[model samples]
Target: MISVFPEVSSQYLIGGEWKTSSKIKEVRNPAKITEFVGEVALCSETDVTQAVDAAENAFKAWSRTSVDERAKRMKEAAEKLSTVIEEHVSLFVRENGKTMVEAKKDLLRCVEVMSKGADTLLEWWKPVHVEGQAQKVQIRKRPRGVTAVISPWNSPMILTFKRAIPAILAGNTVVIKPATYCPLTVMSCLKIIESSFPPGVINIVTGSGSVVGEALCGDTRVRTIAFTGSTETGKKIMSLSSNSVKKLYMELGGNDPALILPDADLNEAAIKRIRLGILRASGQVCSAIKRVYVHESRYEEFVDKLKKEFERVVVGSGIQPDTTMGPLNNRSQFNFVKELLERSKQIGAQVESIGQKLDSASWEEGYFMLPSIVTNLSHDSELVRAEQFGPIIPVIPFADLDEAIEMANDTEFGLRASVWTSNETAAIDIADRLEAGAVFHNNHTVFQNLRLDFPGIKESGLSQETRWGGLELFTDCYGFAD
Candidate 1:
């Protein structure tokens, strides 16, 4: 039996204080529907304006601080994050419903991303000079005024740090609006930085997207918007910001594909990549492998091996140490996955479930769905074309390499793609041809490095998020001559 903890009310962290409003929204634990994690303060337009005003006021002092000073504060925040790692990880699991192991890894990744931002600050401050015949010219990057950061619920803590840390490190004050479904972890992160940062450097507001997001985007005080969510929503954000033409950075949806070639290692390659792409975050990840195109020669064997691997996953409450998977974040997502699964079946795709279902008598309260695999899908089927964002992998077989690449690039979304092959030269050739922001060879798209550029191409997104590229995203160029 899982023990329930006392319910805690969540509040907005604005100007370094926890403020509450009369309106509140209930936050539920997706693993056990009986448990209420807490309620978040439903912020009003006044709340959003206050948060933005705080950020705008702090911009002067924060943007004037030396890069080294900002880097030091960021490093301190990262260290503080490490000290409370276990607490945050436990909270993430309870609130977001990822397994304990997955939660810990996500926290660790947040720490790493924070530290990377600190390192980037130091590197970005390096002096640059250009020699000229008559005079010496120098170029430097300066912080943009105020930034509005909007993150999604899939991995709230990590994405929050990914956007906020870099923006702050680059000398920009931020107003963060984390996803309503998972705001506690982000608030906790804000508390850590609040202790180190000034009162108005990092301001957080919690509310429905319709109310708060529109206010932030519509406000003229905001200079830039960094967002991560669905493509349709991104379009709406773009429309909202058009009045002021605020600079935008968006990482949207992906229908990532992993192609299995005839020369690939049948056992190690297929199982490893599939686990990372399909099983991680229970397939809530934007880069999760939604479709797999296998060479006709090894299609059956690959499917059998993948099914066996999928069977080994233990799904239950996230706190269980042995749990390899957990429930989806909320009922809406649960219903979305179920509806998609049913739609795939109706479209003539073969669906298979692995492992034993936990007793519904006790576990039925939660929004749980078994990890599923759909096979024999047509190249143009909805399951293959759409972004399911669930733990369901659709396997499609192709006769030739050209057909496989064509099918991989068939989707309207092109966030990421991968190829599993032993031939290094052939893999490189295929990687160049694939339409994605990032490509993996002998691996899946889940693998990301801080040094490389991270962004989607075409409809996927418009900006990159690591190294110097990320720092420049929050900066504006100025020129002066005398």
Candidate 2:
């Protein structure tokens, strides 16, 4: 067995202390399944009860602390966390199957979220004086007690902090449940930052979502639930939290589309960004460009360029320096993508499998596949309609802007969409008619869309995440009459 980060702590963090569970689960390296990464305690329902009890006990004192003091501690915690992020990059790659470069970026983003979340909290919590009344009145934000953060596996570290940081800054004690598939990196990061707050302010439990996840959402002690994952699981969380009427912030799945107008530029840099938007994390990201709509005049040219870009990719273990893309994170996702591709072929879709295998000799050892491009498919085909959640993309030709808009808006999901055109006026016009939470003018990817609030419409999600909207979700406004 190949050893990776064997010394890193993976125990459950409860009440500001590391505790062990009776049942243990082994962690495997997704890039090389036979290799052992580490182990995590499988917490039970009783553990969830104890963790929530501790949070309830601590919320009284922590919620009363000055907002300025909370912000100061969050900044300090982020600074301390930055110094240790580099040490766990390899562990992240082994446990999560992201390239070393992507792993580093994932860990580093946590610091930025924590620091910026604190800044947003300060800006959002200022007292607002309301006029036009006989007497003085002011509106202020108050903390929602005990937020439950359940994060997914694809980008675990940053997503957890994206919710947890603001909830804490708003004086809400939190109990976090990291994805069972990738818990080590999140546990390590949370362990490092737990010292900055009082006991029970930050707690984590590791186990199956069916066990720990349901408990966290259904528990009456929890006042709010912030989750990021598939729409199916988001629905389950809603049902569980509904009994208690908990405040819910859900960031669900998306089948995002990109429309390339005839006048759009397909330069080398632009093509590269488009490819990255589709292939990043092997398309495991929720907002990745799942399908593309190119004008009939430029459809052939765009497909040819994208095919060339796909051919240059090298898939293998993320730790290898020469590898550009890594394997799927787990066996379930790997199998799902394989079946989707096969179904596309059976239905007579033009599925072009391109890309070089970094190690053809050991290809069967991991959940690896060459990135594919699908063309000559109907808009309603499963390959074009489903999220896919893999490195398979469909490029459809649209005769006009109206046809393109109609095809893109035909999904139950309305998470994000993008339009590519030289004319800014044309781009805004299309964006206005698109049925998505956020629309981009030229480029649409994680980094390009981070500065603004991320909301989803229709079946995509409830509420929003990131920016001021995220901070506001963990709080409630109060009017003081004088």
Scored by Cα lDDT, where does model 2 land? 0.89
lDDT of 2 by residue, 416-440 (tens): 9999889999999999999999888
Superposed by TM-score, candidate 1 places the C-alpha of residue 92 at a distance from the truth, in angstroms, of: 0.6
Q: For candidate 1, what is the lDDT?
A: 0.82
Task: Give all candidates' CA lDDT scores.
Answer: 0.82, 0.89
Query: Which candidate gets the maximum TM-score versus the true structure?
Result: 2
Tens digits of per-residue lDDT, candidate 1, 328-384, equal 998888888899899988878889977544455656878777888898778788878
The TM-scores, one per candidate, come to: 0.95, 0.97
Report the Cα lDDT for residue 383, model 1.
75
Off-target runs (Cα >4 Å) in candidate 1 are 1-8, 131-134, 358-361, 451-453, 479-482
The weakest ten consecutive residues by lDDT in model 2 span 1-10
Q: What's the count of clashing pairs in each model shown?
A: 0, 0
- The TM-score that candidate 2 achieves is 0.97
